[model samples]
Target: MILRQFLHREPVAASYLFGCGGNASAAVVDPVGDIAPYMEAARATGMRILYVIDTHIHADHISAGRALAEASGADYVLFEDAEADFPFRRVKDGEVLELGNVTATVIHTPGHTPEHLSLLVTDHTRSTEPWFVLTGHTLMVGDLGRTELASSAEDGARALFASAQRLKQLPDHIEVLPGAYSGSVCGRSLSGKPTSTIGFERRFNKAFRIEDEEQFVA
Candidate 1:
């Protein structure tokens, strides 16, 4: 698999481009700002952008996902229930997007927003097991995303707790690639580091380690 992370300092958000290099197929996630970089990356890597996905509607910064998708003739993707003005390909929970030898399985993880989702990626060439997860603001390095972004704090917290539990079921070795880092307002105690693993976060991340729903909400 070929993966590239685009870290935006102005918005303090992270976007991704990844797929099967051998097949020359790729996907972009949570893109922000200029779309030129994404297009250039795909060109340089000899990959065609098949899908452009936005994990959730962003309240922090304007997204370039649609623009990029249109530019590349790729499908613009979002959760089935996401509220958006433009047309997009709605994906359901557990839906798998194939990129030749690489696959991205969708997982509903609403917390920061009602339509929030994460991508569990696997490379068939490497192993059948998942390699990493693109956790868009739901789970971060040192903190969980703030609960009140799209709904009541109590309601969001309850939903987030359930989402966390679902994520906990994944293998411990899978990597965690979050949307934002320390400077973003989405999480309170986020780490500067943009990536982590399930096992490490389960053991050390304060918010992620909380097993009790009440304790986590509080």
Candidate 2:
């Protein structure tokens, strides 16, 4: 499996390009403006862009999803429960998308939005075990996403807590690749550093440390 991250410095959003190079197939996640970088990466790697997904409908910056999909002839994917106006391949909870030696399992970990999904990715060539998670806005380095973007703060927080539990169930060694970092409005205390692991966040994240639902909600 091969993966590359495109970190946007302006708004602190990070997009990903990943898949099995041997299969000549790849996927893009949480893309931002100027898709040239993604196209260039695909060309350089000799991989076809097969999937384009967003963790949720973004509010901070314009998304380049549809444009990239149209240009590449790839499937634009979203959660089955998302309320959207355009057409997309709706993915269900626990659905696994296989591309050669890489497998991406979609986990519907809603919190930042009602339809948010985090990807549990495994590079089969390395190990059958999951190696990392692309946690869109659900879990970050120093914090989790703000819970009031698409629903009431109370309701969103409640949902977020429940969703975070699912991620914690994964092995502690899985690295976390978040969608946004510091300077973005999506999360209050996001880290400037781009990535982290599950074990680190589970032990230190304020939201993750709070076991009580009421405390999490408040």
Candidate 3:
């Protein structure tokens, strides 16, 4: 399996490309506003771009999902609960998107936004261990997404707590690839690195350290 992460130097946002093999099928997660790099990469690898998805309607940058989908004849997808007028497929919780041999399972995690969703990628060819999780704004490296962007602090905090709780139930060995890194304002605090493991973050992340909902909200 191949997973490529594209980092935006100015904003420190991460875009992702995941696939199985060269000249195979691929999917893009949280594509930036520019569509050239994604197209080029897919072309060079001789892969077909089947899906272009966003975790949410980004408040920080304009998304290139529509453009990429149009250019590649791929389906543009977003969380089903999203409040957008854009033409795209609505991905529901537990929904699985297949890209040749790779499968990405959607996990509805609303907190950063009412429609926020994360992906659990699995390469059917490999063992059952999840390849990685594509976390848009729900979970970050060292901290969690802020609670005041899409809703009031209290409301967002409550939702975030539940969402985080759901994620905490997962096996600690899973890999997590968050969207924003250092420069983005989405999360309270984040690592500069693009990738992290659930076990490592659970041990080091401040959000994960909070056991009680009241303490977590505080």
Candidate 4:
């Protein structure tokens, strides 16, 4: 399988593309407003764009998911709980998406929003452990994504607490590839590095240091 990451320099955002060998098929996660780069990447790899998935309805920047789907004949997907004015398929929790030899498992990890979801990708031909988790706004490198993007800050904060705890409980070996980076307002804090291991964050991240459920959630 092949993995590619795109960093939007202006917004300091990150988008990921993952697919199988020969680049005959691919999937895009959290694409930016400009669909050109995504198209170009798929073209270069000789892959047909299979799915254009969004974690949530972004408040930071307009989503080009719908546009890209229309242009490439790919499936446009979002959380089943999120309501949108556009035409797209609702991806439910536990739903598995197939892209050639690659597979992405949908995880309903809400808190940043009521409908937020993360992708757990595994390349069956490569390994059993997840290739990497595409954490939209749920988990970041240093700090977790802010909970107040869509609802009340206090409520968002409460949900965030629970969400972070869930993430902390995952196996230490899982690799994380989060959405936004240092410059984005979507998260409270982000690491200088774009990606990190779950073990590294579990040990060094401030949010992961809490031991008690109440304290951790608080």
lDDT of 1 by residue, 25-133 (tens): 9999999999999999999999999999999999999999999999999999999999988799999999999999999999999989999999999999999999999
Per-residue lDDT of model 4, residues 6-105, tens digit only: 9886666889878975648888888886899999988887888889999888878887788888899999999898978777889888899988778899
Model 4, global lDDT: 0.82
User: Model 4 clash pairs?
Assistant: none
Q: What value of lDDT does candidate 3 attain over all alpha carbons?
A: 0.86
State the displacement of the C-alpha of residue 24, model 1, in Å, after optimal TM-score superposition: 0.9
Candidate 3 at 110: error in angstroms? 0.7
Q: Go through the candidates in order and give each one's C-alpha lDDT.
A: 0.96, 0.92, 0.86, 0.82
99-139: candidate 3 lDDT, tens digit per residue: 76788999999889889999999887887667778888888
Root-mean-square deviation per candidate: 0.6, 0.7, 1.2, 1.7
lDDT of 2 by residue, 1-218 (tens): 88999999777799999999999989999999898999999999989999999989888888899999999999999999999998999999999988788999999998899999999999999999999999999999899999888899999999999998888998899999999999888988888899999999999888887888998999
Stretches of candidate 3 exceeding 4 Å from the true structure? none
List residue ranges in candidate 1 displaced over 4 A: none
lDDT ranking, high to low: 1, 2, 3, 4
